[model samples]
Target: MAAALGVLRRSDEGQSLSGAVLLAAHDLLYEQVPFPLGESSLCRLAELLVGRGVVPKSSDYEGRWYLWWPKSGRGPCRDCGKSRSLTRFSGRFGDDYRYLCARCRATERHVIAERVEQLHAMPGVQAAHSAWVCGPGPTGTRSAGGTEAEIPSAQEWSEYATRLHEMLSPLEWAGFELPEEWDTDFDRRHGGLLFETLWRGDGGVGVSYHPHEGKVVLGPFDDVAGQWPHSYSLLEDSLEIPVPGSGRQAAAAVEVAAGQAGLLDATHVYVAESAPEEARQEFTTHRIRRIFQPAAEFRRLPLNELLRETTEDHWLSSYLDWVVGRAGQDVAPDIVPDAAALGVAAWCWRNNTAVEAHHLETDVLMARVNIAVTRLTRQYICPVEGIDWDSIKDALMDPGWALPDTTPIHSLFGEGWTEVAATVCAELDRWRRLDHERLGAQTTLILMTIGGSTGYTDSWWGQGRWHSICRHILDEAIAAGLTLPAPYDRNGPEAFLADLHTPDRLSDAALDWIIDLRGAAFEGPRGLRMNRITRPPRHCWDPFWHSSTGV
Candidate 1:
């Protein structure tokens, strides 16, 4: 073919891009039995096709090549858009058959261009060399490198003092000019405020607030070395911290983040030492108040016994420090000899009853120790690995899909989980076999996921909208399943009319206990979650909920 095209010198008339030429070219490409052609021969064929007026030029054959390559053939390039695509069709019947296209074959890496400028009249003296990461490459992957590439990428600094602030407002907190002494190892060595989070740095590795290549970019890699690492997001994949409000709200934000991350303990607890005493006490008590009683102001609750059980490195140690010694200290109370201590004793011992009947001789330290243990174990234990807890929970739900662990505390005393497992297996067998039960569970999952809720909500709810949150609580009796629609309130807004009956009887406390089972899966009760998000956006109904009514 090259010989034939070579015999005919470049013809000014070439070939008119006519129907006959297109018909001939199409037939040559698609109609004939597939056959082999050498690279040299292929170029000649392109020239021949050009001479026959199929394509008018060869200077940029690619511009038109893409328009025609979809000739349904025996072998086609699978990865066309990728850099290392295999669009090569050798055309041989059996030996070489993969095909690659012009665009992918033309892909190239960015070249770092360099231009040297000699200094003084002095021999061999050098001023500097300008360098930049020249583009026409894949994307904004590599940093604009080289010492002389002075075009600062508006990404090297943040205005906020902490990583927490930078994340909330990345736009306002964007890049600032460097101090210009950045040539040494200093940038990577310190990793302090300039580019890193003030206090969020964990063992010198902090996250880059900027998203890069759809990955969680990590590093302070020596800019000179120019190598950085990226991982999927958790803290980098397994956990994601929400863009909670700036500064002081970090603790509250992390409280939600930790549970969502399925973590054993809160990973990032940001309460500045300079925070107020009231704030510190509030932070400490907020945790205790979630599961324990006396949600308001209290001097302290005991921690010494729990402290003895724990070591210095325990995850709770630093948090416990704030309220540790404060417990056991005496405060005055009327009519009782040591009523101040009694109040502390009350939080540790009170489980369900409204009454406080511990003896005057009640061991407050032991009682407080028990409370501390329950706080950590029952309420905040990490999500257990390999447990299809949802399945177990489904088995426990009554037909109404009530919350589990609703039994009086005493009822949970003697039975082991083995019996529960048997019941769960039986229940799951029953639920899965029933089409409505299975589909209802799936449909309930869909409603909860009005937006992405999967990661934060258990696969269950991450990938869900940031606003949509689901928390799973586990109770002993009430196996929280799909939320039946809230019972119609005769006195509700819908029932608003002139002649109203007395207000609906359920008090706020009663409503709390009643709704507590709505999303119970395996452990402690996480309180009501709505716009306020009190208990870390709590509860995902059993995957199988017969939602006859609205939630």
Candidate 2:
């Protein structure tokens, strides 16, 4: 048996078969040497071994490997029951060990193609053209999916040109034409003029012309009336007439007056032939008023003209007051509780006192009392609604003053004012803990909310003006010869407190820190009223510092 085993290992065919079987079953244990193999070579080896009666084979088992043949032809094919011919089948690899037929591979490819087709059918995928996908051509190339590119055809370009002309036709109808003397090719060369639509409330469309580089712009009007005199004119038949009169006049006359007041050196003028001198004078007066006074001031002028007349609801009156004056006594009464709470919060912030929950409640009450006095002083200003007074007072008394409520006053205080104050205070506290390097970034965010930043352009809180005030305060503080504290990596609250009292360099870094403190003080619940009247004795700290000193 040993000599036969050695002979089987030495034969070329026997050696090749043994090597292939061993490679296939390398992981199998020697005790499990009779395990099945499915490859063709393994079947040939099985035939060789069986011819020598090394393993049993049934008469029904033909070219099957000995490992795959059951002793009684009873067990399922030792390779797998699915294998019909042991010589024809081989095991396939998968996520888990499984026997796969050739048929399953073909099905996977079909499913992938169907999904790709569905994705291409989505909306806008075909409608939106990208130049990258459609390479440049005289007429842009179409996409692989057969969608036309955005490249415009000659006919389409002509139609777009026609539409542009149609849009501008009304301006031509109104005696305003694109400067005809210039080249027809000017638009092509200069990328065309930017056309802006001017809408009239009276259901008219007007066109305004701005030249490529010219300063003078012209707009045509049906009537010049009370609008800017220097900028508008009414065309007459072949002659230019200046509108006549003063004080109260026709629209054309007012235009002339406005033009004259503006001292415009008119190279051209359009005038109405039938305008009365009174109309002309009024036009000029309105123009003068507009030219000399600011928009807010001009709007508030107590003129009884139709155009200058105030609204019935006193909207303009309230708006002007809100813009130009401090919060009126009546306005304060409406939001007194919120304003008071904010004041108390500001007080606590400036003094470095903990803004505990109880303090917020007590300060709110105090704010209400103060607001009530202001409201009473302005009692004659407007009729006091009984509910308005009671609601405000009750809201102030309530511990949950900052909580959301359905009433308008509650909405304003609980939602608006409280939110702004809370955000400001929180931001201030956040920066107080940051190191000096992050001070500027935090200060910019805080000032942005308070209108202290450059974005405060609307004149809404007098923010631009306040920014100037803040700059001046910083300048004074820096000029006082203060020294900066040594830089630390991670300074905490105690370090912040120490820096506040210590003298510091008045660089952008120092200014940002001081501005934050001042901004917090300004936004604090109590309003600071500086007495500009009294002159402080020598050795006085800056009034701003003293006023903001919390006490």
Candidate 3:
């Protein structure tokens, strides 16, 4: 509990903990505390802490049981009427965040930029125009005076980011906005604001101000000098105030004030749609697509059809036939080989990973693979209890065996398991071509633990004598004249499998080659099932963590 609270308040302020977030923090720290049945179990637990004086309940929220949570937000914007996140309004605008919201600020900056663009090209005060204030302001700036001497503590700056939006946004947009995903830190750090009156002077002079850093820069906008370590300051005459007078004009107008604001290149706005999130999602989709080739026609291809059209590759043919026999009723176009076929495939997929010696800890790999498969396939096939022959057989015989709200795997046993187990073993046997002894040992273990039995898991994954599974798998592959690609184990199979149990020691580039060798991985199911996913889940694929758990 202490550790969880420490982590929650690590940003160094009384954190406004929501029921869900509070539970997550506590559960993460207390891994043994398996979540109770209700979604609000952890939330209700907060009442205990509050009642016992373990923590004080925040006045702002019933869920916020922190001793001293931060302020709500800048509040409803007097200008725009929307309570803006700090991304759009900063405390720098002063205690009340009086400055306009990001959009309103943009509208204002555009106003200034447009005015300058018009007057700089107009006759009379044909004086070149300048910007009054730009939204968010100059960003990604690397200038000097503004950053040379810092007045605030680094810890304090960190607090400012969280304090403003972490509190404000969550309190307002609770369900819609996630705390970690909020893009406020970059907004605060890369501040290069320009809030000077549009200069009516000629094009020779350019003005840039960084109020946050306490400095004003003056030079030609295109000066290659990289504004810094200034020898001159803002001159009284350099800054001339031009009033609203028709006659107040310069003798000659240079062209249009067409350049971007002195420092604002239009980057410092509050981009509600985060660039990192988009990029991460794109990369995930690409990685999944790399292995799971999209077959829009997959839904149309029935088990019977795919079963009928098989290659002499014997194993593919056997696997196809097994699918057809199990899910002949799944040919209804939308059902696509049916849910049982999916469940069987998932069970088989997990065993395939285990036989390949993917992870050091059997339970860890199995659970994660189960998660990945269920997510990828849209819960059509949930291999939640890990892999076993009985699970596969039930899925094969009963179309609705693993469908949503169906009987749990343990409770559903099948008489046809021996046949299914034998076929599964043979399919793995032909695909991997392991020796008789290696095949026999695994076949026995696989069958013995038919109906959700974990009896043999220790020998299968632990440091037992039989746990040379990684070594055995790799040894067989090498004997078959399958040497790794150049630059990996050029030293021979010994050096390659030397760190087999701890594959993470190998470099990432080496792991990519290893993954390619291990059938390029079927880490995810090809399609999503709406019954399975209602919200987004974070995915992180560690390139070198497994595929050895063979060594």
lDDT of each: 0.26, 0.28, 0.31
lDDT of 1 by residue, 1-551 (tens): 33333333332246435435443444454324233433333444444443332332222343344233322121223334332213222221122222333232222100100111111122533111111111111232222242222322322222122222222222111111112112211132112222342111111123433211112222321222212111011232433333222222332343344334422111113334454455546444443332122111121333443234334534323323422223211110001111111221222223212213222222222222222322222221111111122433432333332212233222232243344334434533432332132222222111111111111222111111121222232122224343322342334323221111111132333333333434455454443233233222221111111122321
lDDT of 1 at 216: 21
* lDDT value, residue 401 of candidate 1: 26
Q: Top TM-score: which candidate number?
A: 1
Which 10 consecutive positions of candidate 2 have the poorest summed lDDT?
533-542
Compose the digit string of candidate 3's lDDT tens values, residues 41-136: 344444323322223222323333231222222334345666542222333212322334435544544454454335445674332111111111
Better of 1 and 3 by lDDT: 3
Give candidate 2 regions above 4 Å deviation: 1-127, 130-194, 197-551
Q: Mark the regions of model 3 whose C-alpha exceeds 4 Å error after superposition.
A: 1-58, 61-64, 67-418, 421-551
Quote each prediction's TM-score.
0.21, 0.19, 0.18
Best by lDDT: 3
lDDT of 2 by residue, 145-195 (tens): 344323444433332232222233323222222221121222322222223
Q: In model 1, where do residues sit more than 4 Å from their true spots?
A: 1-156, 160-206, 211-255, 262-355, 358-470, 474-481, 484-551
